[model samples]
Target: MKNSVFFVLVNILLCACGASANAPSEAEVFSSAHTTPNVLMIVIDDLGWSDVGYNQTTDLLETPNIDALAQQSLSFDNAYAGAANCAPSRAVLMSGQYGPRHGVYTVSPSARGNAKARKLIPIKNQRGLKTQVITMGEALKSAGYATGTFGKWHLGADPDKQGFDKNVAGSHQGMTFHYFSPYNLPNIKDGPKGEYLTDRLTTEVINWIKTPKDSPFFAYLPYYTVHTPLQAPEQVIEKYRKKGIKGEDAKYAAMVELMDTNVGRILTMLQAEGLSDDTLVIFTSDNGGYRTTSFPTPIRAGKGSYYEGGLRVPLLISWPGKIKPGLDHTPVINADFYPTLLTLGKAEQPNQALDGVDLTDLLLNQQAINSRDLFWHFPVYLQAHHARTDQGQDPLFRTRPGSAIRSGDWKLIQYFENNEFELYNLANDLAENNNLASQKPNKVAELKAKLKAWQQQTGADIPTELNPEYDADINQKMIDKILAKKTHH
Candidate 1:
């Protein structure tokens, strides 16, 4: 009887051990056992879709580090920026709302170009992001993450006021006056004489990541390289010049390479600190490239224009073992990142409604997200960079007050100036060279109805009142001058 009792006791103990093994621990339940990943988002300023070597569109530019990252990441071919330009695009990403929701449609004043060229009174623009809106940093920080932003924060004057625990060199300023040290930026102090801005920003992020912490971190490194005032290291520029790429093109190429090199450094540090597998790395551009400097070919116009070139950008998401590396052609925008990161970090949704969809399934299992129409509303005017080569509707302006929607493969752009519609079948013509509005009335009607409904839903303002300063003759003369110059060239 004693021997039988001993065997029974052993059986009970074994069962208890098995039960403990099957049940999840407290750390596992909360995902605090390093299961909750770190987020490192690197945003490049004015980098084009075809600038990277993985795209194989440009032979002049070299980006080995970015190309390597692309090989191990889920590259998005149809990813787009929230807006065509800098300030508005950054606002959309931060707020996870459309331009209409935040009332930040363009940079500075809504009136751009000559007053006589603007037909309608454009909507008033908001210079900075309102503090009331919840930012990604705040959302992640609320979920027990250490949030830090190490670069441009064009949304507001202070990033710390908005969800970030640490802000390096971010401010309301759109672009840096100089890429070298003595940047004159409010937050950052002067470094050595020739210290580059991109390099300094990357170093700051690396140092921030190195700090000991109990919780995971969200490192937002928005490098201000590859933008205007085209300056690069002389040696790197010389290297490009030797390859027959001289002048501004050589300087641009050098800037791109330097940015890629910094990205490599970050990747190396993550591995060194044993944070590679525990981190989710995202690399993308704020908008499309500057037209004259890095024109995205076969995609049409760049920067301010709402063409494929201006909206489309390179996107790569890498999570060592968690996310499988491959190419995803699904159409996505920067605003989508807001909900996606929140979901991945297990953060609660804010009180305000989010316009973007959560991409967790798409990021993890390679499953496709629900089909939805993408919209862009610009109730403001943006003048052309180079009227002759901007490839916009007209030479005078890159974009008039307009609203655009992309439903499936069809894209419709409605201009408030003329109440006119320009439609294109993107699947067949990615360049947006052919307008099928005249040929397919049913398709145009369908898209227009959808766009109209979206406009009403989003409360997108449509400028209708005519501008008192608009002069038809003056606009015509400017157009004529641009045309004459193009013809002469």
Candidate 2:
């Protein structure tokens, strides 16, 4: 009997050992079938939905390279920037959180425009991202990836401290003082005399990619092209001039073409390096185009306003054979890229809560995510660039302190100053010409509740105190002067 018991114990031990040997390790479970994929994220400053050739919205500007990329990418038709301007939009992309969470509603002091024009005291803005916030660079670096940021890093003074292995010219400066060499920007030594900023940055990225490294890389190329100080190579400028595009229009066109050419260069480098198939390339804009230079028509307003033109931007994601090339109509925001990238890199989530959903299944298997409301809270004021042509609610300012919510086809904008609401069904009115707030009271109530709840949940500060300097008469005079100038022009 004792011998029989010994044999049974031996058999049980052998079975347990076999099971343990066959189990997959933790790393194996997290890894892909092949080595990890490299990520190349390109963010253009103030690039509009209608700017690219794929959209076919304008014939004045040419973007052959961007158009070609669109052909090989899963272009999103309803993609939005996290905010209507540069700093906040970039903050959202980096931290994967909404404006309320980071307190970066707009650039610098939120109380923009003349003191008399502002009705309420706007919420103060956070200049740069806090060190405590874990950026995409930090997350990807933790996952054993070599990270680099090549151009504009407007979030902070030093991207190196924010988790980047290499930061070329990233700084707190929003716009470049000079587009050519003797650029005089931080972290970038001046190149050859008369070297174009866009071209130089592209070369820097290509050189970085060529450097030998064991782990996969995350290359963030945020070009400061097509922003302000609308400058371009004289030759490119003359090319547009020859096409009969004159004035700032010609210069803007030249800048767009230059940016597109640099994009082509990057694509060529990726192909030459044999990294095309192994890399995931995402091209998008920080925000919508500026109204004074570029026209974001058929979708009212531009840049600072919360209209479709202000928030909407071109988004293209390409992973060669991994993701099928086609148009995706799903409404997505730039904040979504954070979780999506972390999942692709097989990285652990940060301790802080992320507002975006993981889009792995949607990208790889074409499985659509469940419908949910997207929110935007901007408790700040942005002065108008061109009050006459800006297509905003009013001519005085582009946007007042407000919060907006989009649920399915319905969208509602709530103004903090007057407690007014503007509701529109985006499916029917993409231009947002019609305000259906009074027409649909129930819909307004439904969306308002959700917006309020979101504000409460995120601890979004609303501007309530009336501005002490606000003058009704002065505000009217300013409006009249703007109108008269428009008429004179």
Candidate 3:
């Protein structure tokens, strides 16, 4: 009888052990997790790294909503836009390729302006994303998720042309004169006169989220605030002016404040809809701040240049219950958004080669990002000339439209214009204040070879011979007109 009791006890212990082994551990669940999270890409126009409250580069600006969102999200401190300007960067974000590859190099003009003027500047062949290539919107749409875009669809003339099912306030134009006016390009559903453009965009987003809680969605809100011809409602302007800000700076600050408030409203809407946990919200700028006086802090140079300030922007991603909060110091680019969003949606990736990697893995798993080169090409430079201001002299000779190849901490800027070169160890010098090309001849040569090799592999289009006789100034008025129509009303 004692022997029988011992056998039964041993069997009971074995059964308990088996049950424990079959149970799922938290780590195991995290490893093979597949949740179809809705994606909200909130793209702020011309916002700098210092503009957001979390980065704290400027006390002149207030972004409480963004700051609160950052607390719950994984913030990328070293994130960069694909290009220094709007169109190219937006193109890169839509298609997981560099600006040079997709052919949308320059910013789009307002729809009402001269088409002949556009031919002269000829947006970097990278302007129009190839129809054959899949966009993030297309991927989500195919997966039964509704895709809607609210503002600044600079990817193409029509969001329908690029795959967005709903495109409100979208246009080919990249700039606007007033946030609210009848001046908007004809296609968008223009709001009432005197309406705040940013506020209208937020209302559209909130309405979309409220109606579509049944399936996943991808809502892209690219605001036209703080770009150029900086205009804001007088009420908002007075609010900031009371704080000692006056003139154009105060108007710019007011626009940013309105943008922040609207963004916060959208976040609040997501929470109210009870979609915060199942949705992923991302806030980033197309490029750096357009204002030269703007502080990018550790980075040097502003928009229209290849400096860190021109490329780097604030990146905040909030995925409740999935992403661990706090800062991610690793470098990320706009191109990564395409692949990362598709991966999160559990959609099939395109067969072609993509320049961006799946950043979600890097953010969640804390895995070391594999060393990969990032490249940029800007052929035409537009030095901004504001009304009657000492806008500074244009460089005597334009640098030959150049290209840069960054691997690890070393970045080599190759000026094809004169075969001139500049190199920096970005690890130590974020401002790019020092040029080490002459000191490190061997490293320069090595990086040059790598850049050339990549150009060959990617089949990058070398600048074709064009007559220097072609003048870009002939269309200035037309370009301005097109830019003005991007606002509200």
TM-score of each: 0.92, 0.92, 0.84
Measured over all alpha carbons after superposition, the RMSD of each candidate to the real structure, in angstroms, is: 7.0, 9.0, 9.1
Candidate 3 contains a number of clashing pairs equal to: 8
Candidate 1 lDDT tens digits, 104-144: 88888899999999999999998878999998889999999
Query: How would you encode candidate 3's per-residue C-alpha lDDT over 55-119 as one tens digit per residue?
Result: 87568888998999999988998788988788889888888888656666555431112333322
Per-residue lDDT for 40 in model 1?
Answer: 97
289-401: candidate 2 lDDT, tens digit per residue:
98887787688889988999899999999876567778998999989999999998999999886888887777766779989888899999999888887888878888989
Q: Which stretches of candidate 3 lie over 4 Å from their true place?
A: 1-32, 108-127, 384-400, 464-489
> Could you tell me how far off, in angstroms, the CA of residue 346 lies in candidate 1 after the best superposition?
0.8
lDDT per model, in order? 0.88, 0.89, 0.73
What is residue 453's positional error in candidate 1, in angstroms? 0.7
Residue 218, candidate 1: Cα error in Å is 0.5
Report the candidate with higher TM-score, 2 versus 3: 2
